[model samples]
Target chain A: DVKVTQSSRYLVKRTGEKVFLECVQDMDHENMFWYRQDPGLGLRLIYFSYDVKMKEKGDIPEGYSVSREKKERFSLILESASTNQTSMYLCASSLQGALDTQYFGPGTRLTVL
Target chain B: TQLLEQSPQFLSIQEGENLTVYCNSSSVFSSLQWYRQEPGEGPVLLVTVVTGGEVKKLKRLTFQFGDARKDSSLHITAAQPGDTGLYLCAGPSNTGKLIFGQGTTLQVKP
Candidate 1:
């Protein structure tokens, strides 16, 4: 079975602080994604990486950046966390195909106070 | 822009009840996937339908893809408390990213 793990399950940060959420997959998938899920908003993509050092912005990428220095790890960075940035962050990975199924990690609930 | 719309944002029912959730889209997709997310956990893929007018069954759950490849439905028979979760449908875009629906939260009481 494919497994995706996140660095933290819950995190708290003060306003204007830098925050990082990490994700790792054991399936050796080539595609990884970051998304923030909110009530009534579903899951909005923040960023995605198709390969090492390759990144793409999704629908809502503001105030967020991503790093994919290795195939198994993907990190989401908040330049300066704000209260509005508090959300449940999810990381997913899929095989190198458009129609492949994405396996998601247990989300990290970030609280920006 | 491609968009997927899901109907009945919420549903609550007793055990042994039947329910169905619908997912619609104006744009066509090559495939659609259904996922069930439990509280505090990431969404888990339940099923994926690729061909138009296709039906697939997994235990008491049935999934159907529309003939136009633009819609899908999930029906659960005799739902139990264990079936309670948020159901989400998504389709891959031309850019290879997925577009997700608003999701349907279902609570099956014992």
Candidate 2:
């Protein structure tokens, strides 16, 4: 079975503070993605990495960045946390193909105050 | 930009009831998938439809893809409390990117 793990299940941060959410996968998949899920809006992709050090912006990439230094690790960075940035963050990994199933982590719920 | 629009954003029904969720898109998709997500967890793949007019069944759940390859639907028969969750539909874009819909939140009261 494929397993994806996130660094924190819950996090709290103050405005303008930097936040980092880490994700690790054991499947050695070539694709990793970061997404923020909000009520009604579903899962909106923030950023995705097809290969180590290769990144692409998704629909809602503002105020979010991602790093992929290793095939098993993908990290999401928020330069300055804002109240509006609070949401459920999910990380997923899949193979290089388009039809590959993405395996996701438990998700990190960040609350900004 | 390719967008998937899901209808019945929220649904509350009693156990043993039946419900259907719709996912529509204007652009054609090479493949479509349905996922179910519970609280605190990421979405889990339920089914994937790749061919036009495809229909797949998994126990009490049925998934159908439109003949145009631009729409899909999920139907649950005799819904159970365990069926309550967020149902999401997604498609693969021309760039090999995944695009998800707004999602449908289903609540099955026992």
Candidate 3:
């Protein structure tokens, strides 16, 4: 079984604070992704990384950024947290394939109060 | 744009009942996958269908991919309380990024 570990399960931050969500995968997958899941809207992609020092913006990457300094770890950054940014964040990784299955982390539920 | 659209955004049923969820799309995909997610947890992969007109079964669950590879369905027989969760369908987008449908949340009461 593959393991995708996230740094936090629940988080709360004040407005204007910087937030970081860390993820590590032990599956040696080449693709990593960040998505925010909300009611009615479902999961929307925020950012993704295919390799070290590589990042691509997803459908919704306006106020978020991603870092992949190493192959096994990817991090999501919220430059300035806001009330609307409060939602569940998910991280996933997949092997090098166009149709490969993505393994997901436990997810981080962030609340900006 | 989301490539897949799931039906019945929410479903609640009694244990031992059967239900079906559908994932429909206009564009063809190389493959599609189903995932089940519990509260406070990430979505977990349940099954993957690659070929058009393919059908895969996992115990009491049956999965079918449309002949055009643009749709799919999952039928659960003899459902249990443990089957309650958010069921999601995902496929690869044109840009290589994965696209997800508005998942169907199922709640089964015993």
Model 3 CA deviation exceeding 4 Å by range: none
lDDT of 2 by residue, A24-94 (tens): 99988999999899887878889998899999998899998888999899999999999999999999999
Winner by lDDT: 1
The candidate with the higher lDDT, 1 or 2, is 1
Q: Write the per-residue lDDT of candidate 1 for residues B49-107, one digit (tens) a residue.
A: 99999999999999999999999999999999999999999999887789899999999
For model 3, residues B1-110, the per-residue Cα lDDT tens digits are: 54789999999999999999999999998889999998778998899999999999999899999999999999999999999999999898888777889999999999
- Better candidate number, 1 or 2, judged by TM-score: 1
**Which residue pairs clash within candidate 3?**
none
Q: How much does each candidate deviate at the interface, measured as C-alpha RMSD after superposition? A: 1.2, 1.3, 1.5
Q: Which sections of candidate 1 miss by over 4 Å?
A: none
Give model 3's share of reference contacts: 0.67
Best-performing candidate as measured by TM-score? 1
Query: Scored by CA lDDT, what does every candidate get?
Result: 0.94, 0.92, 0.92
Write the residue-wise lDDT of candidate 2 on B1-110 in tens digits.
78899999999999999999999999999889999998778899999999999999999999999999999999999999999999999988776778889999999999
DockQ (C-alpha based) per candidate is 0.73, 0.76, 0.70
**TM-score of candidate 2 to 2 decimals:** 0.96
Share of native interface contacts recovered by each model: 0.65, 0.79, 0.67
